[model samples]
Target: MTPLYQVSDSPAVVSKKYFSRRELMPSQNSSVWQIQSGSVRTMTYLDDGTIVTLGIWGAGDIVGSALSTIEPHIIECLSAVEAVALPLDRQNKMVEALAAHVEQAEELMVIRSYRTVDSMLLKLLGWLAKRFGRTVDNGQLIDLRLTNQDVAEILCSTRVTVSRVLTQFEDQGIIQRLPLHRIVLCNQETLRRAG
Candidate 1:
């Protein structure tokens, strides 16, 4: 990772106050930094007519891909958000980092393709278990704030189907749905087996 100061255009300025949600793009050669201080929703529009729910970026996760020969932005914030904006030069370095990151993300997508819809859900649960799980007294809880609609988009299924699958998971005690966009993973091993 590049040093934050080395990449910052204005190293002297750092805001303590959280930024509310907004969209941003690099100005000329500028790079924008978005830090999710807490849970926030996001939607990304692909070049195709399809839209993807990028889910929530928990605290300490960074958004914005700064590196690409062609402008690296294709994602947008879908709700009121909080983040930090950085200069373009620093963003360029971050883009280099993102290149490697994209490879891993793509690998995960490939894994998602090999399975049936039910398997996909289970795989997704497993992936989230590692990437975003928070240990609770009972089990690991996935911190991503996703609706069945969001899961449908990600899984390339209808919302109704996704909801049914989630219901099945709930019935099997594989997961627990909390109010306000939280999912509790009650049994990751069962989820893995189901997947």
Candidate 2:
């Protein structure tokens, strides 16, 4: 099977650049950065300085300000990142990236549409587990290192509310919190059914 973002037989030589956590990725209209490791969240601020998360991108995913028309587009590293710049001249590859971006936005919109914060958060956790988690003995481990504030930004909720809900989830055995903002989705299937 072919990789999702495969390079051509004669690919351009591009060096992978490292970015620290919370670092802002450099944007170039002529190219996009393909993630080699770690993850990033693209965001834009409203007039009131409220952050709106656009999307979360992981390995093999492409991201850049050029992909969005939102002013002040920013890609903030969620973890230590390694990425290589891919020229936008590759239309086919960029098309795939754009499609993925659209799909993710749609999915996130659905999750956010849930009436209650608990329901929205539950679905968001499940989505993240599916996309970025690794299977563990008991459940999937989400190692995104996302803060309560980060999650709140994604869901358009308050940090206090997110913290409370996360605690509630832990108390209910729905999730297990680990260090460095990691979480184990203890019973994602049950949560999915309940939600």
Q: Give lDDT tens digits, candidate 2, residues 1-195.
A: 434444444545565799999999999766789999999998876444767777899998888865665567789999999999876653567566875676577557656766789988988998898888898987889889899999999999999999999999999888999999999898757446533
lDDT of 1 by residue, 57-152 (tens): 655655454432222234444455566655545444655576556545643554356346776787677667767788887677888888888888
| TM-score per candidate, chains pooled | 0.47, 0.52
Question: What's model 1's TM-score?
Answer: 0.47
C-alpha local distance difference test of each model: 0.58, 0.81
Model 1 stretches astray by more than 4 angstroms: 1-96, 191-195
Steric clash pairs (candidate 2): none
Determine which window of 10 residues in candidate 2 has minimal summed lDDT: 1-10
